[model samples]
Target: MDASVIVAGAGPAGLMLAAELRIAGADVIVVERLPERTGESRGLGFTARTMEVFDQRGLLPRFGEVETSNVGHFGGLPVDFGVLEGAHQAAKTIPQSVTETILEQWAAELGADIRREHELLSLREDGEGVEIEVSTPEGRRTLRASYLVGCDGGRSTVRKAAGFDFPGTAATMEMYLADLRGVELEPRMIGETVPGGMVMVGPLPGGITRIIVCERGNPPQRRTEPPAFQEVADAWKRLTGIDISHAEPVWVSAFGDATRQVTEYRRGRVLLAGDAAHIHLPAGGQGMNTSIQDSVNLGWKLGAVVRGTAPETLLDTYHGERHPVGRRLLMNTRAQGLLFLSGEEMQPLREVFSELIRYEEVSRHLAAMVSGLEIHYDVGSGTHPLLGLRMPRLELSADGRRTSSTELLHRGRGVLLDLEDNAVLRRRAAGWTDRIEVVTAAPAGAAPGGPLEGTAAVLVRPDGHVAWAAPGSHHDLPTALERWFGPAR
Candidate 1:
């Protein structure tokens, strides 16, 4: 095979998956249709869960210092994100273009072969592997790999070529997004519902102001190119009675509230991630963040299977875990669209939601949902509170040195954190040492009374979710080990 994996598209999901596959010691080749990066920043910043994912991978410092905020929104209502403990706040202003550049650089440094302007023409998956035909500058070329993953945005060619079943709602109305120069507008960070529809204004890094306008009764349009800046300005004027036609246009685009998800995330040797698997309204900037995470969840499992360390059934868990997340994504974004983009008919429901959000529990739930802090996988029936949840960051002291649970995961391998230095536990996991890291450490600082308080030991998956915890798990150490890391040697 030319490579173990072939990832289509160089967006956040593709780049991240390539990096992760390389980390798992699998050869990867990434193909992108664009010869160079488009400097367009469709997604701005990431959620708290994405921040933790990047931190655990040791990629946060590469982004320099990010601007984060505890303030967040659901639909158009406000929610305080501070209630979620032991995670970084959501980043607010880093552009998607910047994120792509960083991820591409990291993936390349990890030895991923990224070929630009090599558009995938077709694909065929045999029983053993997958073959893809591509159009490159030199000539048409065919590459074979053990697996192929599609991260090629909403209208994915691979999804079509593989015949995956995608069923959901279609675009009903259109909204405009524009970045402008030489314009000063009051910041409506969340959004404001006007007589016609909703309008939002926020400041960007380089003296640029970003505005979103969703005028009621605006029908969705079919277009191959971006809408004119005047169109956005006209909608803004109609919604807010403000004319900003004199402002210099940086870039303008249009989007819709079309929601969709594939019935399955995998089809034989071909699998899907990012927008290829799901699509939703760009509410609360969840699209790009969720896409990045989809790659994270799929990367290591596919790598392990390709490397012969794990059974192919491990791939089934990818669909089982992320498909539900995608379903909830579509549901929440569709609900947000109704709340934010609808006419006056939605005001009563909006008012009711506003009142509900006033309660701390309601706000916390909404905040966690939107920030991705509330996701919990079904690892098994375990009494531990954090059994299926993402492992909280815990400061640790091992071998007279300070380390962390987050630091141990930089290698993209499973971690068996032995909090009490259990020699028997280490012996039980000895056979899987090649596939996981066993660290014996004691809690430091405020970690004692927190989430890890009663846990004697914890088993964390490569994607940072807890697979098992001692003093509560129903399964023994080796059972959880074989379940996630394959049978021991």
Candidate 2:
């Protein structure tokens, strides 16, 4: 158990995978190029699914309890999460630095060895495992692990060395972003559209506020020269018609989002997640959220495989489940880019959708799209309603216990759900002891004395997702166990 998994890159994806692996009792090591955590915030927000994952892990509260969330719509207008059918429907505004910090600290608490200023130079993989080479201050050193994860982001050395093809269209527009201090921009009322351009502003924890501006033109998509800082502010002034002569500029950079995705996410013992696996525009702020979600999807499965609780075929599902998700993110971001960056010709279309967002159903749909809540896997069949859906928060009142699905997951074990405890189903689920937790709920959506007809013995995964379910004990529970949890090891 020297190195069960070696995670490259200490960004959100790597740190999250390290945290999950450590929690699953795996000897994990994290490698990053940065010497210390960057105080500058990267991405601007987190979706509901991301928050649910954090909440389920009991780490959300440790994020300093910042409750600044936008329950409205993206671009502009209003939306509703209650009407959405997916796992997470809301988007929470939190910076990348905060998320990475929380995950880094949590992984450290779980005793994950995090190496900084050390870049992976090479990796050799065979049927046995992976042999990784890294360049450190002292010199070069090699480490062996059962598996290696490349969360190293785009331009991933791991993906390149593995000879994976990242094929897709890069962003058509080049954008400039800067963090401003002493600015008069309204943080909450950010992301505005003007006649000639679009401005996205986000006020961070401190007085620093983020400003993103993109011109609607056919300018060269790539920037080789250092961006003119004054021009950026001037563009903001011209777009928003606001004077910010007194604002102090902090950090500035220019980047274009290339909507590229690798055809294969895994090759033998090496795995890719986040930007390493897929690249898309940050127009909707989906990059960080998507990457963290990718790690969440892969982490538990990898752990299951390492523990001999899952078949080798289980690893293949990582690509099957996530590749489509990456494609969807790219498509959605591209559509958003067209709407936000289009010229006068597209204004009518944007106006139509903008008006349509007023409807709860439409708003919820877009919210689900922007927040990463609309994902539902065709895992098996339409037999059970809870299968492949997120384990929703429910109330409990058994043994004077009152809690939610989030609280029950703190122990980090799967739960066997007996909603209302229907007699036939209860008798059928009597044998699933150690592998599945049994929780009887009442029909009133309470703890006990409820009917479990439509849903029976819902099995939640280690990552708070429904893995397997039986509407009745009539279905062979033993087979389901063998297929999902690998025959009790």
Candidate 3:
């Protein structure tokens, strides 16, 4: 095989998956159609869950000082992200282009072979492996890998080539997004519903202002290229009665509220991630953030399977876990589109939603949903509150030094955290030491009534989700171990 994995598209998902596969000691090759980075900032920043994912991987410092905010939105309504408890706030201004550059560099440093201007032409999967034909700058070549993952945006060629069943609503209306210079506008950070439709203006770095205009009654158009800046300006004028035609246009694009999700995330040896698996309205900037999280969820499992550390059934959990998340994403984005993009007919429901959001519980629920803090996987039959949830950042004292649960995950391996230093627990997990790290540590000032209050030991998956917890889990240590890490040696 040329590589263990071949990832299509060098966007956030593909780069991140490549990096993760390399971390797990699997060979990876990433093919991107673009010759160079576009520098287009379609996605501004990542959600809080993505922030934690990056932090656990020790990739945050590479981004330099990131700007974070507790202020966010649900549809067009305001919500305080501070309502959710997390170690990091949602990063607000790091452009998607910057994110891609950082991830591409990191993946390359990890020895992932990234080929630019190489477009995938076709793919075939059989009992042995997957073979992909691609058009490269040199010539057409065929590459074979144990698995292939598609991260190639909404209109994914791999999705179609593999014949994955994608069924959902089609586009009904169009919206414009433009980045402009030589223009000053009040920051409508969330958005404002005008007489015609909704319009949003926010400041970007480098003296650029970003605007989104969704004019009611504008039909969705099929186009090969980006829309003109004048088209966006005209929509803005129609919505807000403002004429910014004189402003210098940086870039302009059009999008729609078409929602979709594949019936399954995996098809034999060909799996899907990011926009290839799902698509939704770009509400609350969830598109790119969710795509990144999808890669994080799939990366380690696929890597483990390819490396023979785990059975191939482990890959099935990827679809089982992320497909639900994608379904919910489509649901929420479509709901948001109805709330924010509809005509006056939606005002009553919007008013009702506004009133409902006044309650802290409602706001918290919406905030958690939008920020991706609400995700929890079904690890097993466990009563622990954090059993299926993400393992919260916990301070630890191991070998007379300060470390953290987050720090232990930097190696991209499963963690058997022995909080009470139980020798028997370590012995029980001994067989899987090669596949997981067993750390005996004492909690440093753990809160009395916190999520870890009664937990003696916890098993954390490589993706940061808690697979098992002591004092609550029904299954024994080795049972849970074999379930996630394959049969012990």
C-alpha RMSD of each candidate structure in angstroms: 1.1, 3.3, 1.0
Across residues 372-484, which tens digit of lDDT does each residue of candidate 3 receive? 89999989987888889999998989989999999999999999999888999999999999989999888888778877776899999999999999989999999999999
Residues 195-297, candidate 2: write the lDDT tens digits.
7877777766678878887766625445556477787777777777877657887777666757899998899999999999998767567789889989988
Please list all clashing residue pairs in model 3, or write none if there are none. Answer: none
lDDT of each: 0.92, 0.74, 0.91
Q: Which regions of candidate 1 fall more than 4 Å away from where they truly are?
A: none
Of candidate 3, the 10-residue stretch with the lowest lDDT total is 188-197
Ranking by TM-score: 3, 1, 2
- What lDDT is obtained when candidate 1 is compared to the true structure? 0.92
Per-residue C-alpha lDDT of model 1 across residues 319-359, encoded as one tens digit per residue:
99999998998988888888988778898998999999889
Candidate 2 wrong stretches, greater than 4 Å: 68-70, 74-93, 186-191, 218-228, 237-246, 398-400, 419-436, 440-454, 472-475
Candidate 2, residue 407: the lDDT equals: 72
Better of 2 and 3 by TM-score: 3
Residue 284 of model 1, lDDT score: 89
Error of 1 at 370 (Å): 0.5
